[model samples]
Target: MNLISKLILGGLITASLHANAMIIRHDVSDGKYIQQAADYPAIFPLKDDGKTKNCVGTLLTPQWAITAAHCTILLEPDSQLEIAGNKAKVHSIHLPPEYGYMKAIKNEQGKIIDIEDKVKDASFDIALLRLSHPLKGVQTFPLLEQKVNVNQTIEVMGWGDFGNGLEGVSRKERVNDRQLRVAHNKIDAINGNYLIFNFDAPDSKNALPLEGINGPGDSGSPALIKLPNGYFVAGISSGGDYPGVQTHKREGKYGWQEYYININAMTAWIAETMALSITKN
Candidate 1:
């Protein structure tokens, strides 16, 4: 099926299934180790009212943030899109170089015209957040031009609530808690515009089903893969599916994860944008 259909079906499957084990709450007394990764400094919580809404972003540059455009636009109403940090502000938004308007075929039926001219490159599914002020004490992670290989292990950290959906509480104690959660996974597939990863379920050795990993709150969180020298942003947490276990399937049969818009694919766009921003400033 298409990306949209996969997302909708995935959501339905996740909602109906409750056979998965509840995530255990570990001790909060110890320092959050997940928050210590290089990527965590740039990961910020995106909030709507006083509640922890979604993951915001870190300032890769004074003007740019690496995030999924689908999560930033489709999931967030225009008015509610605000950055959360020591200081929060919103400025202009930028998409990649090829992010101009495009048409989409709806199944075998008619075409869906530009629903919002603002979102043209949903296929790439990546967006850059421009902040009103330069983020203090934040550093951009290096971008990799080469493709990451399958079976290569990577670490992902995010403020995504540990439980199930929006109503689930965060794994951390405080809403703003910079506490990070680290999970390991390997690359499963490399599509033209996305990358798939296979990770184990919470406390389970078996791999999660297709399109299941970090849930909704992890929408824009970066997947960090280790390199010989350091780490690179491999993928963004896009979406997942969690169907219940059945006799026909194994115990961990229903956990899978799919991430759209791998950062390496947009290296040129990222370099170009930074260069332009530097010149303008």
Candidate 2:
């Protein structure tokens, strides 16, 4: 796990409670994203080798995709993700330009000693990936026009981890890692730069009692808000405060306090980047 808000659920394979953990699909979305349940071919699963790393992305257009800035920074930049079983090469990676990759200091054992303690820029994690080839027939989502409000119910999704001790163990036998899952989260805070929410269950009596949470393998996943138009991308998974089983297991906070890069705040950058002729996947 690259400790600066573990991107949760990317292909970094097994993360140490601090990196890309997937959505904890209790009722499912921290545990699911924009569309509830695993809807194939729409929300493309960005995957690598089953052993290495993976991230989810939304196709804004056949030629472009939206994901976290950390996707380019944390994971291998030269590596390609499998989309629809075809190679989606990164032609260009566009961060805010002001943002730089802030890496965690790890120990000799490769465990993250601390999180992103020195990063000053909050507008650092959202990014756009210009694809090598255009995807066809996949539905693209719009960005939420207004800022999300506190207490708003948002649908979240990821292809990250699930099951056991909050560990990045596999659900569905871990064989279907690319299987997209669903879960829900509520907006708890709205700062100008970030959107935050917790994964603890809103109702204890509800079925799927497992609190919906996000963890390794889910980096770059989208947080969606439904409006009259349709489901819109509101936030991109960025850094987060996670209590790995070694520490937070007994803390009673089942869901991590996930802080996502506010997509609405960066729409200008996204639009500007998309229009640019730059390419790098």
Candidate 3:
């Protein structure tokens, strides 16, 4: 089966086997900014054929979407890029040569064999999706002019897989925690081209808290910075591991999330790309 089907099936299998279940029901506000984000959040479904694989994106510009390099591999050049406020036909996909990697092989004798070819890096796990047309949504979030200081609180939002499905079977009835959950943590040391968040969960037994969050569907959700004027798109939620009772590193350590591709780190790249687009047009 395809990737999305596999994911759905896996969720089902896990739910059937595990008796302890967790459900996510987050409160989403109808306030101005929250409404805007809820209505036009940058996140988009990455589709292959007719299946929804995963969500990956950022609203860098009204006409441009930023996402990881790995996500681009599944995309066709002409795939439709849809957001809350607008839809655009992808005109082009640009990826850096060093963004992707491959593994080496071994012979039956256990000797080292040929190594796979190096794929593109997705430009430091980053990419730009140029839309065939512009969007008419509210002004795009600002770009960080300087590198965001470590420990600055940032907001993240997404509609991803949450809780065991045994609690509810209807897909549309699943919880929508669209509220912008805020997490305050220092920057764990950067890894290659990604930024990491030191998300400390509570010491209590209940592992699933509404505010203390991160999960499967949150990948590629924008890490936003609230500035004097407004919020700026700062980083992308990559992935993280939650230590269960058996896997807890310490008695009190909570789950941690590591973000990849600091938008500020790619400020020059963003400026140059937009400038070039503007100039060319």
Candidate 4:
């Protein structure tokens, strides 16, 4: 269980480091309303083998979609983007110049000693996908440039396994069939290139009606905020952890924090990459 394995095989594992959770709320009874259908068509799933959707992506352009770099490892030649029940072929996958695995420095006996930090110790986890053809009629979202303030509310949408905070995201609560869900959370903090959201208990004053955080199979989904003009993507789903909780419990529990790759901080790289990708296409 090194960093490489976590990032490479995370999507297939229940609690891998790179596996982003589905939206889990404090109110389990609201599951019916929290589930969505055909909403946020711009956010779609990335199939791992042309069959199973292990990660999700956002439609930045008709011809371009963005996702986590770690997901690229599981994508196959026949991997397709499932959008509104239609599929688009992936022409190419592009990683940022900074994209690379974080390896732990080991001792002579292979016990880990030190770790390397890059891009502020966060994985440059973003990636871009070039589609073989432009997606017709689907709406696209713009990346947020202005800094998002702490305590501002944002929406998270994706297709994955979900459950209530009381039982967490494991066991029978995790559905085999992925469903589209949207949840809201306020920005707890901003750490380097990541946006942090904590899953507040239903009784907590900070909890929203559908308060939730990311969970398994939500990797690469977008944390969005709507402005007067339209919706803007502020962060990409990355990973989460339960701070100071020693239960070693499954993810998506109450008090757990979800980390999203801050899209605002990576707008420069995203814009540059999209421009270059379009030219190549």
Superposed by TM-score, candidate 2 places the C-alpha of residue 106 at a distance from the truth, in angstroms, of: 15
| Number of the top-ranking candidate, with TM-score as the measure | 4
CA shift of 65, model 4, Å: 0.7
Per-prediction RMSD in angstroms? 8.7, 6.2, 9.6, 6.1
Report clashes for each candidate as comma-separated counts.
11, 56, 8, 5
Tens-place lDDT per residue, model 2, 51-140, is 434556776677777887655544434546556545667766667866655454567986545444333464567778777778665567
Write the number of the candidate with greater lDDT, choosing between 2 and 4.
4
lDDT tens readout by residue for model 4, 144-234: 8788889999988665456668767662344634556788899999988778889899889999887877677677888889899878888
State model 2's lDDT: 0.58
Each candidate's lDDT (Cα)? 0.49, 0.58, 0.50, 0.69
Per-residue error at 105 for model 3, in Å?
20
Better structure of 2 and 4 per TM-score: 4
- Model 3 — which ten-residue stretch has the worst lDDT? 15-24
TM-scores, all models, native as reference: 0.62, 0.70, 0.62, 0.81
